[model samples]
Target: MDVVIKDRGNIKWTAIMLPEHVAAVKQEIINLEKVNQPLLDEDRLSEIEMLIYEAMEYNLQLEFKLFKKGYIESIIGSTHFIDYIKKEFRIKDKNELTHKIPFQKIVDVQKV
Candidate 1:
């Protein structure tokens, strides 16, 4: 999907995502939540929360790195993955450009 983030001048920046990447992030969050749920102590809960956030942050960073390295699409499926990309990449107006296109198609268009 394509998400559009606009600057002050209404200049839009688009973020592209694959369904698989989104799903993988969602699964990661679910797994973290599952791991965190068993802890009852406040300190442990806090630590788990922090860990979850860190994991998500790290995942987003890694995804961006992969994107830069030309791994444009993900092998998993989740919309939340795009949300992470939006936040990590400082994207805006995600609803504006959620279209699905082939990765190669986007790359080809970008070349123009």
Candidate 2:
């Protein structure tokens, strides 16, 4: 993972990761949020939101990089990627092994 911090003072950041890595990081963030739910103060909530955004940015970067590398057959939605993996990997059971990522908010990676 390679991240380029855009606005240090403003708390805006960006990161690039492989598609698999993005999936892993997204799962990690979700797990962290679950564990920290009890400590959800204003500041903690803001931190969690930032973590989610950062993970999403990295996912978009992965998509773009894969497109550039010609690894993906076509540009697809993130949800499609999840489905594709499940089908291709023959993952029928959704358990702790499969990190269920929450829906991603729209992120404008082009502007970032």
Best by lDDT: 2
Model 2 segments beyond 4 Å from truth?
1-37, 60-97, 101-112
Report the C-alpha lDDT of model 2 over 65-106, residue by residue, as the tens digit.
111121222222222223334332111112313223322221
**Model 1 accuracy (lDDT, Cα):** 0.33
Off by over 4 Å in 1: 1-39, 60-112
lDDT of 1 by residue, 1-112 (tens): 9998656431221134466866776777666644111214666446534543564565422121112232343222112223333332221122433333222222111100
Model 2 C-alpha lDDT versus the unseen true structure = 0.34
TM-score of each: 0.21, 0.23
